[model samples]
Target: MTANPLDDPFYYLNNFQRVLAWLSQRYADVLSSEEQRFIEDFSALPRGSQGLLVRMVMRKGLRFRHGKLNYGEIGDIGSAVAPLLALGWVDEQAPLGLVELFEVLLKAEILSCLGHLIEQPKARKTEWLQALEGHFSQPQTFRDWCPQLEDRLYSLTVMPLCDRLRLLFFGNLYQDWSEFVLADLGIFTYETVEFSAESRGLRSRQDVDACLFLHDCQQRFEAGEALEEVVAQVNGLTLDNPWLERRRGKLLFQIGQHGERIGDFALALCIYRDCTYPGARLRMIRVLERIGEYALALELGETAAQAPQNAAEAQALFRIVPRLRRKLGGPPVPRSLAREVERLDLHLPRIDPTLSVEYHVQAHLHDDAAPVHYVENSLINSLFGLLCWPAIFAPLPGAFFHPFQRGPVDLLNEDFHERRAELFAACFAELDDGRYRQTILRRYAEKWGVQSPFVFWGALSGELLEQALDCLPPEHLRHWFLRLLLDIKANRAGMPDLIQFWPQRKAYRMIEVKGPGDRLQDNQLRWLEFCHEHQMPVAVCYVQWAEQGA
Candidate 1:
């Protein structure tokens, strides 16, 4: 019945405020007077204005489009920018000449789209400005612009490196440093790589406030800093806002991990006790066992065994607890615990039967046909990539231009939906005319490989795509496509294994393989139901033990 510390909003907000204050002092010499003033005046602004300012600074350009700014969540864009305008930081009525427009297009990375202008290099600045304005003013015309270049217009890369570093940190000042630390530990789930050598050493500010503070901590930790010193530093540092409050448990868990890495098992155990991280109990038990406290480990394991969050945790406890009990010369695991473990063991193996089924189906397929590559995750994502295109091409105003969709958590707003709706309708229209297939093929032909924070493009073979187009029923395609759009995150996984393709006949059939005792998962069942509804040619192939023996 213990209350969560993060339940109070101020828990993170207060910490973020403190970090900003620390940054102001820490980088006093490196930051300009204007930059320092901005930091000092940040907290004094209204919360909405504060957010808007952060958004503006994070954007690529010093000047944002007046038209796009009108639709953001921050009420009264003019009122929000009034303070910034008075500070002489922003130019509200900045003139957009031809040269400025050309630079903007180049920075936005959409210059390629204006090939005619590039070919006619002698085009006047006024002509360039007029062309740019004309392109962006019309929704239909602008929708054709390469979606990837949307955020190019908003980049601050033209700014001095130190200033860019300040903006990067300021935009993410409210984030939990522990989450970044955990990412370094490889425990945080991430879809893309954020930091690179090119990014790190670009600036000349030797004492630049570390843009990624947790990364800096990790480097120091690796250089043999004492566990207590690291802990003291972490305690002294404050960087979090409401968005990061939800990650407090992850932070605590990572701190415990830090202790464990330094061989401070006792310290790690103590930290785990206070950590609300998932699987903390198991982690604590492991630490106890490492310290030869077998009896204590068994006691903790038993409690964990009784109420695990999932089959995986239950299975871990089932395997580890009894072994510890036996090693400590204690009695066997209780009957209830043993049965529960056995049940989980039986079901857990069925959750992802792809590996098992891949081999079985591959062996059965013709040599000319490639067996199911088990890229259901990538195939659906590639299909829905267009949904994110408009956001990429002409990103919403303010801090909404996150190419990787990593920050500014409030991504979806009325404007976002409106744009998505337009894209969705246009996408479906293309689908009806069979242009969507061509687009997917063209995207593949262009070798638009997986770019982190953007769409994941699977290496879909031409043969497979061609066969799929020929064999997959239109009704089934529509059904699954609609379902995927409705819930991209949830629907992306658990697809059937083994798409056996016949190049000779231009045919393909999706096969969901199951071992003798395995059953379909909920997601798998959902896919099957949709296929059945559309009368798609899909089959469930059950491999019996006797058949395997043969």
Candidate 2:
């Protein structure tokens, strides 16, 4: 007897084919006649040619150069291009003009540095290109202009969004839903340093392909497509790549999610077992509980609670498992179970004194007229922002220059720590000479006066700025600099809340205020620890509700 289709290894690919068929039918209204015909033609093409067409459509430029096609899975670049060329989807010898050059540069994020040149009135495209070519020809000029040109060229946006969506969703069938869901699940893996250069390119390409397939399957399942219909399409479909094996768990997790969405709790639970995906176990227990399988749920929950990978997972399982056991009319949790679960509550609300002590202390001092202060996270961080101005707003050489990116792309680089001493030395030199103050004021007046990605900039008031400058310590500033360099994403949040200024003493205190039932999170603890180590004048003020007569 043949193995069940559900147990087949190529089940995923089969499901993908069904989804493609479904998309072709569902998107008939929105897709152009040519697009529909293209889809039909695409289905008829050999799998290799089909994959090549997907890549060509997804590739960066309107025209594909013969030489560039030598890389990646596309065999005999000419053969691949022939079909696409015949279809008129890809042009081999497109003319490059001034407007096209500007658009290409803009997409490449190189336009910002040369924006002034391009924005010149009455400058033709030919003139601009000629000027740009001249600049490129002079080695000294190119070096002085952009040291990172090579890196920038590698990072240019290849496919336009509309084109990507047309290929990805096959014309509005699923739209951006696949990208959203995949991103949410952490499937895209934007951090590229982990993979080899060649693997990085391959993985990125596969990510697009996988997202298209997953999106189709998800849409089909949600649209009430039958399981048999999906399984039948999978009968002979296969993907022979290491990427498929690597993504098997994620694919299974997605299948489980689809199952759950369609109210197939048992199917979801079974798929979750095969998923090996992070958070799958937790999801399985939830599914089991939902389906009235109390005994199995309790058993899995008890086991998971004891050996969870992290404190958060342990805490989550501990919180829910006990409740599950109780609902099942089971005996009270054993002593050993209780002991293991007890550590999970170490950082719980009852033990945290932040809320009670911090908020009340700050509240009582509000009546004192001598020391003027405001509860703000913006003030000090904004001062740090002034120090970061050159690196933050400086038009980077080849960085993906979007209007939204208000900081250096390299700010998140792992090697940024190596440049910390040099960067901060310059910042401190400006601070000591009072140049930073001028720059800060100038920046505030010019660019930052409107809006910025840094939350502190928008909330910075003149009074607060004055207080920050007066109270700022070189050591505390250095600590913040180090913290920001260490990890910009992690360090920016959880700063001290209330900053109180003593104008007479030329001093200020960084106060972390917590209301009743509030606690310091991990990031806040890290900041507080840094302050303590640096001997910075930082305090935690916890509020007592009863003392305040609330």
Candidate 3:
């Protein structure tokens, strides 16, 4: 392996070739006819032409100006682009509207093109765009739009095709070619897990199309398209893939949240009724109450309370259900008393205005005997990740598909823990037998800088790890790890902001800090409640700046 992958001028091209080959070999059944042709044709092209095409595909936009495109490795831009234009992969006569034109041209060019219509010559590009929006309803070739500006624009007509390939490789559209560059630069590293027969994210052509459709729907929804229209189109498609189904649920959940934000309670209720996304029921109860349907809200809340989906929903119900009952004019239900946690009140001088409240408390509480680290959620999560590394990264069907994945695909899925129960049980057994400390430390050293969803390596120091291992007992670690497994998504967050460890006593205290006017959030309350129930040493620290509250 090369120390620096980019030392070879064709590094990016090499990566692209690897992806194409991987897909051709592993995903041959799923590849569309057009995709297969592109792969075959792309491979046969001269190295320069291949490099140039990869450069354009990796870039932000489809349109590229010949003068702006320069790569010494891919010498002679005009020569490189000839084969692409011939293949119709890159178009010279692609139409561009005023908005697209404005993005490419300089201020002077825009002024020259539409100076007659502009009331103010010195106005911003946005104002000029609005001034010309109605004038040019039709899109024209960049040359036709700006004939006076002597520059050639090449637009890649195969952007949609490239995007499909990218989606297949990354398993999603959000991650792109930048992942390759990051890995090459040694900024991010990923673990290699064995891929099984069913490891691929998109197993069929229909699955690929559905994933692309969802991507387009998300784009349209974010671009402020008509809500009902987008929702209708989104709801029209029925996906068989559970992963895709979860994505659809999440999109609908977001749409429902947006409706609530815009005070569309009826629409939110309609969405929540059918949406299976986690927390939709909670949102539904709130929406029902918002629209003055307290009885209905109570009905649903009570039903959910009987068997809440997760700790988050159960916590929300505990608060909302009683208030909802009172709203229905029923007998006043007593508020359930909160589990008391250790409290620390301080009015500390703010020496560094740049530092956060958690840091301020950490600095004040630090000593030679007791060292406080602003760990927040990183320490525990990192410890759990390190100790349970083998189980988490174990190769299972449908878990790992690509070389770049940070964790298993089913990490957030409901059955993630159940699928790997035996592996996790073995890992947990290490904690019971006092072998967890060695396992965690060994994994921490070996897997250092490797990507993990749970481990915050930047926040985890060797000293902190050693201190935590010495102080935190195996039983407490087991409790925390088990809670994380119960609901990985919900329980992973909302940990205390600071942890002070007493290595001499083999003791530690997690402290959740709250600044002035900052009350505990629902998640924080849930974590505090959990700690209280488990008899863990945790505290809630309230800080009032002396300047304000003295």
The candidate scoring highest on lDDT is 3
**Local accuracy of candidate 2 as per-residue lDDT tens digits, 1-550:** 8554445433333434454564454444444555457667767766545555555544555544344555445467666556655655554334443445355443334454565556554566556666667544422222234444442111122234334334434322333324323433444312111211231111234444544565455567557677545433322234443333334455567667777887978777766775555668888988888888888988998888878844335556866797788889878775343211101111113333554443445445653433445545566567666666555544434222122233444454545446455656777687666777666666665655432334354467676666666667656676676677666655677787766777667777777766557877766766776777677777766554452222
lDDT of 2 at 541: 64
Error of 2 at 309 (Å): 17
Q: Of the candidates numbered 1 and 2, which has the greater TM-score value?
A: 2
lDDT of 1 by residue, 203-250 (tens): 223223433454455557668666666655644545443223324355
Decide which is better by lDDT, 1 or 3: 3
- Tens-place lDDT per residue, model 3, 153-221, is 999899899989988988988888888889989899998788888888888899999999998999999
TM-score of each: 0.39, 0.40, 0.94
Q: Count residue pairs with overlapping backbones in model 2.
A: 12
- Clashing residue pairs in candidate 1 are 59-154, 60-154, 60-155, 60-156, 61-154, 108-152, 147-392, 147-393, 150-393
lDDT of each: 0.54, 0.54, 0.91
Minimum summed lDDT over a 10-residue window in model 2 is located at 339-348
